[model samples]
Target: MAVAKLLLLILGGVAQLYGQTPPNVRPPTEHLREQRGIERGLPFVKWCCFASGCFSRPPSSSHSRTLPHPHSLTISRTSSHLSSSPKPPRSPSLPPAFTIGILLCVFGGLIRAYCYRALGAHFTFELSIRPKQALVTHGVYGVIRHPSYTGAFGLGVGMILCVFDRRGVIMSLVASAVASGGGSDNDQAVVTATLTCVCVTLLCILYFGFTKRMNNEDAMLEKHFGEEWRAWAKRVPYWLVPGVY
Candidate 1:
């Protein structure tokens, strides 16, 4: 039952990401965008999209020469389809943490979907507001100024947690560490401490990146929309988390 939830969450998220992508876009442009990202700074802007199977190798590159328009995306295919990855060698099952991660992913994807519907043509992974784009305030935007960034942060953290299960990388490392200690009580404590530190570090890093993106978006929207943006921001003081952020 729990595993079903994880798979369904992944699929639903993928559907939202890919189904919303405009078809006229292509992959070589995406490659060029990443190249520009590398020149500007770290390429973490699209990290959450990867977790939900949004990035894929561009089909033959001959189709795309010009950079894709800012409003439209060119995510070519979904390489990490759940039905396609090699059947994970079975263990007892996915961990409780994996289920927790799945729930977070579901929550995040639903938020993104809401933003998509709210923003309509303005919803995009790239960060450029269309000319005369109205500042969205209904739905999730009514409470949070940058709901998309909030959703992306949750999606990234959930992806990290999902990797700590039987079929993922973190658990394998944990098991090895547990074995190396000869199963001592001290080993258990050390392992727990180390794992906690690692997870916190990762989540913190993801949060920081998303926060930066949100701040940038806020500045850009305020510049573009002027007083209209200011009014929306005033009403929705929170960027990522309500009452906390």
Candidate 2:
């Protein structure tokens, strides 16, 4: 019950985040126009229509001219029929895994926010340092050399967890079989279970793999900060997680 409540809270937070608009950025009319543009640009609805065979090619000007009046009327009726048809049933729900994933994502988001706040003026999306950028060795930086990456890794793990289910497992195996071109589909449930275990193992491997990026960042910092960076590295040897990393 507590877990369920927590999940609902996380969902509410996510919904709020999705609905949030940038403060004082634009007039209401301009914002509405931008929102409309974004909605039109999104491929989700189009993909859904295509998948359900509801999508039809728009009538070209030439094609429309060639079509007789009666045929055009029939086309409109066909479109109406398509629209009136019942939608496919919803997929099976996997609430437990999804809720856990959302929790992890929320935690990760908090970590990212903390890191961003701590970095203040020094943070940049690019590898290049600002002219007056100081080496941030306090707060979140003191603990992790790349807290932002840590947050991103958390998000990745969360996303994987989100889809980690029987269906996901089966799909993964199917994908592997297709790629390899030499696998029987027998005992798929057992194969999928094994694949799920392997996926968890891979997630661990990927988490540790962030060390490669850490090394790259270290190199860049060494080039930029020289002795100061070396000193900071000595003080905070851990790239992420104090003892384990």
Candidate 3:
């Protein structure tokens, strides 16, 4: 954990150093030549010299002014207009949902580790139980029959949120809209809503499938342990949740 924290701090420091301009640093100035060329309606050009010693030059200013060109291609210096135009409002910083997700992932991983440690000799990658394996009804196992599955589910949720889930998407859209100095458009709102629904549907599907698999595993355990498993099940009653399956 200390190593992880140190690594995170290092990465954050590096990102901060590289990602943002220093307060003391001034914005780059436009070159006088480029500004003059723009004002004279000349096409922007770069002088390139090859190893073979080939060179090229843009047309002279007089010839450039008389040449027919699309209006869209013309460069206009509208610095005053731009400066006067209403700037988009700075977006308010959002709660650190990604950090929360990372915490969840860490917590889930710890839970899984605890579960495995509690299982000890009985812990197996496969569903099959060893001949002398005893029922684990202490620690996390006491609370949930499938503690590993609970951890796995938590990990899945954490990963979803960490990457780009409904929460992240909504936060991004809200931030973008706020930065653009307006509320989301109807189309954008619709898309957001649709994506949210899809995310929910996918979560529900995963939950349903996981529960179905757990039920099958429970049946297999019951067959293996018979009355012992029945009594434990009666005591616990729930698989992943307390008082709720």
Candidate 4:
């Protein structure tokens, strides 16, 4: 089941890469961009997601690591040591947490596709109103005013966890390095602190940015569409999540 899920994710991701329509690229206003707070996190987050993929594969008898084996390290306050035992073989099964994250990734990916179809060419990564663009209110928008953002938030959570979990990319890399150098537990502690800081900052930035961006869009649309926007806002009061602001 885990292999099947991973296969599905890989196939879906490949298909999306081949034929995805990117959101509108027009830069948002300076004020809006500042409120967005995604300038740095965007690429940082993406790099983390992509780099984490190399750690996901099961170790095959056919392949070996150039660096110290990530799983060989045992760091303690007294010392860091490497295991001398030959590695045991394992299947491609995923951790329960990772499996849940992958599910969220797929769910969010589908919702993003839905939003792309619904919005057509109006979807913009940065806040920008196109000339004479019609307001989109049917379908997902009927449930929540900012469905794309909901998908993004879900996707972002999955992506972050995939790289930051206990048995994840960060720990794997840190373990390998520590094993090679005989580093202390402090190294792991520092990494943990950094990861926690990044996650907290990411959540805060995204929350404030999504909220600000949505309201900014609403204000712009209301100005442009007059009663049309007002009626839609009246009908759907929620922003990203339904019934929870």
lDDT of 1 at 10: 65
**How does residue 229 of candidate 4 score in lDDT?**
88
Measured against the true structure, the TM-scores of the candidates, in listed sequence, are 0.63, 0.53, 0.54, 0.68
lDDT of 1 by residue, 197-229 (tens): 887988887776666666676787888889998
Q: In candidate 1, which residue pairs get closer than 3 Å at backbone N, Cα or C atoms, i.e. clash? A: none
TM-score, structure 1 vs. true? 0.63
To one decimal, what is the Cα RMSD in angstroms of model 2 from the true structure? 16.6
- Which parts of model 3 are misplaced by more than 4 Å? 1-96, 165-184
Q: What's the lDDT for all of these models? A: 0.57, 0.52, 0.49, 0.62
Candidate with top TM-score is 4
Q: Using lDDT, rank the candidates from best to worst.
A: 4, 1, 2, 3
Lowest summed lDDT across 10 adjacent residues in model 2 is found at 49-58
Q: Which run of 10 residues does model 4 get worst, by summed lDDT?
A: 58-67
Off by over 4 Å in 1: 1-94, 166-169, 176-183
Q: Taking the tens digit of each residue's C-alpha lDDT, what string does model 3 give over 1-245?
A: 32443343233223222212122222134211122211222111011101101111112223211122222223334443557675674433222544554555556566666776787655543345556667888886787798766765665454445444223334444435543553335645565677667667757855876676677678878987899999999889878877776
The model with the greatest lDDT is: 4
lDDT, model 1, position 51: 50
